[model samples]
Target: MDYIANYVDAIVIGGGHAGCEAALSLARLGKKTVIFCLNIEAIAKMPCNPNIGGTSKGHLVKEIDALGGEMGKNIDKTYIQSKMLNTSKGPAVHSLRAQADKVEYHKAMLKVLDAETNLTIKQQEVSDILIENARVMGVRTITGAIYYAKAVVVCTGTYLKSKIFIGEFAENAGPDGLKSSQVLSNSLLDNGITLRRFKTGTPARVDKRTIDFTAMEAQLGDSKVVPFSFSNSAASIKKNQIQCFLTYTNEQTHQIIRDNLDRSPLYGGKIEGVGPRYCPSIEDKVVRFADKSRHQIFIEPEGVETNEMYVQGMSSSLPEEVQIQMLRSVRGLENVEVIRGGYAIEYDCINPTSLLHSLENKVISGLFFAGQINGSSGYEEAAAQGLVAGINAALKIDAKEPLIIDRAEGYIGVLIDDLVIKGTNEPYRMLTSRAEYRLLLRQDNADIRLMTKGHDIGLVPDDIYAKFLDKQEVIEAEIERIKKVFVGTTATVQSILMAKGSTPLTSGMSLHELLKRPELDYKDFAAVNLDGPELSDEIIEQIEITLKYEGYIKRQLIQVDQFKKLEKKLIPENLKYEDIKSLRIEARQKLLEIKPKSIGAASRISGVSPADISVMLVYMEQLKRTERANDASVS
Candidate 1:
């Protein structure tokens, strides 16, 4: 017997990183939202890596914050250690990564969700998404309670009929021994949602007391912490950081894994899902890179409260005995006791091509999908999708235009565009290389790029938006001031330049030009002028980057303009690609299947070539001419 329980404007399934962000976004936008999870304690749980943000992923987190998402803010509150990566490279690649206290992070997010007046958190597994006439009605719980909603966002992170495997042993469970949603797969399949089996694994957690830290190199966090959130500052969130250790795997470790290849489920053909190519398991890495003698591994603390340490680069699904043998072969982990052995978990995820750029299903009007359910890996990627999906779902209810961030806008846009167009065969991970205009889509300037959009969508608060606007104004003013502030070829200027290891000025130069020098930086200006605007580190960074990369930025902007033109060449929804006689059979098939919204999107499809794009442009022009002729004849 099914019972009517409650009603809400929207329902978000799965309380993982994606679910938290989606529910919060929907609720904050004045929509009454209810989030369902198998267990309340699992809300925003870091089931795999006990860290957030890395390389390109940091850009996503900053963009998420810029767009009024909770991840960056929550991470700022609960991170145990913080470090900026790729500092030796250009500013474009500089990314902020933080080690999170997994337990505390979860609690902090739950607190935020609890405080949201329009949001409800329920510890119940959603068994079915009730649909009527190709639109979402609500979801039915496992206990046969029907909760109605105008929209539903599925964020089921690795819990849809998930099964964990270790050697030949397997169990029906989610990450960290959580209950898997077994019946929901059928519901999704019945609703015509195509599902794919994808696999991802996590490394073992070793008992901290049993590990030998002396044999490992101590990895320290940055002395001056960098916060992930744009709303936060270095001074505001300073604290004593925790220590992580670095170790490596030797020939012995490799030998053990190679010898036990037959016992490994992945190699033995016991696991059917395709694993991530980038983040492979230990055995897979050793097998794939046979020439490599050693692999780097980081031993990181899970949290301050727990005595378990996460083995960073050593994800495996070998048997317990083999895992023990593998661990003992490593240097510092020679005698380390395993608190939890690593295993790979396979789950059902949808082919992201079925989703629109807004993350809404094309077949089902009010159905949205985000996170791992969209075949994307990593917490940051999941959160980015969640925020967009949540905002779009709310906009749909409000009868407003759906927010669509194009490739030229932010990394979030690039992430979605790739997933929607290319459609990954394996779990998709965000990479800086994936973004074409990475110079414009930097982590530091995420707020400048997308905060306005976030504010216009009713997600960013007025106070925060005001702060962002003020920062923008100050940065612009400072850049203008610097460009006009002339420095003469005085002895004082030469000495200062010489001391800073920069080429002595041959003639008068502006502060902006001085900053462009390879050896000179904005900080060196303190010696030149004491009267310079008292600016925060953030503002100074923006000014320096803007001046240093002015030429490159301008070039990218021009490229972006070209990209946007193709993006603006909208494809008519009803246009039959089969009618375009010039298109190749594969191109026509792909175009018909994808039904891309723009020429730019269609061009990105794997099978669609440049020649096909030219054909499309011609056909569109022909169609326009025919329409114009028809109008003229009627007149």
Candidate 2:
């Protein structure tokens, strides 16, 4: 067969969310990049839920935006309904979730990718990763075209040997009946990459007109909107939002599910892949949580232009007849008409432990993997990995240091660390509880924590970085000024304190101290402190959070300092675990397999015990002493 040959700096396979961010990051970093997709229209497609940023996933999007990726900005532009979840809780858990017009979100992201200067989008299926001497050379497509490049990123998502199951029927297809890449899995296995089978499912989409919203609880967006992107102005994206409805499954729904349990692919021992534990199918939920009376069902709009509504919380791989039967058992969906039936998708994903913190493969120097291909489950997780992989690929090509965000730095750090070190048995999803440093990794201050790093890496523009610097200066100055400004127990101050239900000051105290009171905040003292310059809501939010959580933040910073010590203790790449006789069999085997980059990551491996880590630490110190002695003798 005649073949076409081309050359580029980077080649990105699969144009889902991960591929999009990876390609964009490379292109923006001035690398000649090409993104190959099975279908161009599926670029940035939300194959599952038509929403972005929920819980810790929201934190991931914010960090991605902070680091100059495009998910947050795109969601801000195309979201039809927006809400801040967990407002009643502390700021650490507050997440911004938005229901998007799926079509617009895809179009918006595609536009950004299209406008990128050094990027080219091609409709092709990458069949093989071309590698030489354990380093990525390029990729070959099914079309027989070979493209040579300095780096290659595989963001195949749920398309590698993808198989969809609905009841007893199964078909080899990607999401939305798209083409699946069959050859890549074999190629990956041939290249010495270990692969795992994982499955995830999506809820069915029903016609909006068929749902009786009057019977369900109406869920509305916040009256005052908050944008997800730091670059977006507060008032710019605000508009009248649409409504989502909530209903619950009754006993009848459970009965139908229970009666049809044998028919479900999951329960019938037909699904070989392990599904996500957190986002389980409706059948799985019923079987596991038998004591629960019902599960909540959310009816979300797919888009403004379409009448299709997503039947959330009811994802299953049951037969089509059973799906319709179970859905009809719900209150508002009693007469629901299904547009698309829910099904489970099983695909090939690599064992992420084979990759380093930079997301580059340990064996293949210039090869990177992101998204579901790395055993992660969500779009945000995929995009975050994509951003990191893309940035590192560009840095590697330019002979620069790779960007490695630590656990203390951001949730993205915690995510990557958990994947590369601990390794997940099933599809991994990010949660607030997973991050030990969630206090410092809040969504609101994502830019404050990551913008400078993004700017240094050339992903963030100079003007935006300058604005970020200005914002930082204002926040620091305001915090210092508040700490110095004293307030006496005067009538005005006492009255204001009483009005806010806070205890009156004993004598006098700094404004910062007053702001630290549980019931009081910077806003309550705005009238008394008339001399201070008016600050934007974003600035005020930072000031308030800093003062209120000063003690907690300081404590976390101390913990971070301790963490950095272990992370800094680099594990020699060529060090052989088999040489360490004191290590346990399991620990030695795991260490030999993973080849963790640092002591900190090694300690987190599942089978590596604390005793083993202690032995390794002692060995490392002894090794260092021996190396010094040898050098002295040679000199």
Per-residue lDDT of model 1, residues 1-635, tens digit only: 99999988999999999999999999999999999999998899998998999999999999999999999999999999999999999988999999999999999999999999999989998889999999899999989999999999999999999999998999999998889999999999999999999999998999999899999999999998888887888889999899999999999999999999999999999898999999999998998999999999999999999999999999999998999999989998888899999999999999999999999999999999999999999999999999999999999999988999988999999999999999999999999999989999999999999999999888888999999999999998888888788888888888878898888877898888888876777877676766688988888888888888899999999999999899889999889888989889999988888889899999999999999999999999999999999999999
Pairs of residues at least 3 apart in sequence or in different chains that clash in candidate 2: none
Full-model lDDT, candidate 2:
0.93
Clashes of each: 0, 0
Segments in model 1 whose C-alpha atoms lie over 4 Å from true places: none
The 10-residue segment with the lowest total lDDT in model 1: 522-531
Cα lDDT, model 2, residue 170: 97
lDDT of candidate 2 over 210-321, digit per residue (tens): 9899999999999878888888886999987899999999889999999999999999999899999999999998999999999999999999999999888999999999
Question: All models: lDDT?
Answer: 0.93, 0.93
TM-scores of all candidate predictions against the true structure: 0.99, 0.98
